[model samples]
Target chain A: DTAVSQTPKYLVTQMGNDKSIKCEQNLGHDTMYWYKQDSKKFLKIMFSYNNKELIINETVPNRFSPKSPDKAHLNLHINSLELGDSAVYFCASSPQGHYGYTFGSGTRLTVV
Target chain B: SQQGEEDPQALSIQEGENATMNCSYKTSINNLQWYRQNSGRGLVHLILIRSNEREKHSGRLRVTLDTSKKSSSLLITASRAADTASYFCATERQGAQKLVFGQGTRLTINP
Candidate 1:
């Protein structure tokens, strides 16, 4: 059973376009997070939601927004995607704020 | 700006040998976690040690935490060629929901 899964394993789009990545976690975790891993392999947290409540939001661009319609799902939407938006996005979930996270395979986004 | 700093950025050893990696963090944390990541994949949680705990072990992995020194180490015994991967330490800051990861220590185990 896949604990965390993301749709559209790969995404390729042009600038000014919009794309969304969907994530689902059946681990029954209350907290879910989005992280971006750059070419340098530096992974940074972008956003985190707990029990469907937004908790942490790093200094992410306004073009990127995270929405959690329910506790089991969290989706990330990028508006007017730019070249800098190209990176691997990973979805992670934890039982609480301080537990080990179960991460998804990742969504490789390419913006041209 | 980096919270976790792993030493010896990379290491190479023969199969059956033990591999060790160290991680040092800047701030106080509720717990520290170790994760393994292959070349271009997602991270897999290995183990987690809370501030109150000193050591924890799982399978062939052993972790030790020293809160006073703000450091942690992961030791993998009986390494195999398949153990060649990057290991990272993630620190969950006290009261912070997000985890800060280290710059990873890449281990290359030779058969």
Candidate 2:
């Protein structure tokens, strides 16, 4: 079974369109994270939630919001997507007190 | 800002040869980890070395950490064609819950 799973493996949308990406983890981890990988293959952490509590919030724009209904699911909602929003979004989870993370395949979002 | 920077953005070597990748961080860290990512896939964790540890080995993968210099290195012996992938180094800073990743080094293993 896939430990971490993300929906909408590929997404293409117009500018100003809004969309959401869903992520789920069955590893029973306490912490979940969202990372953005640019075309240059630079990975950056966007947001982090530990047990449904917001713990880490980078300097990302307000257009991007992360919601975690529970410790098992974390979703990202982007409002008025811009051209710079086109990139691969990855979802990951790690157990409490554990440093290793399990990542999902990733969702490629394209804004045209 | 990126916390870690990898050296030799890209490297190509023949199969069975050894490959080495280096990572440098800006601040103190609790632990350093190496991950591998294939084309169109997510990253897979390889090994981790703590700040107090100097070296660690997992199978053919060897990792070394130097806390004084805030740097680390990963060495793979007898690299195979399947070893062609992007390698990234992530550091968990002291008192931080998030892991900051490096730009990544693309390794190509020629058969």
Q: Which numbered prediction scores highest in lDDT against the true structure?
A: 2
DockQ of 1: 0.79
Q: For model 1, what is the C-alpha lDDT against the true structure?
A: 0.93
**Against the correct fold, how does model 2 do in TM-score?**
0.99
**In order, what lDDT does every prediction score?**
0.93, 0.96
> What class would a CAPRI assessor give candidate 2's docking?
high
Candidate 1 backbone collisions, by pair: none
DockQ of every candidate structure: 0.79, 0.83
Tens-digit lDDT string for candidate 1 (B1-111): 568999879999999999999999999999999999997788999999999999999999999999999999999999999999999999999978888899899999999
> Which 10 consecutive positions of candidate 2 chain A have the poorest summed lDDT?
A94-103
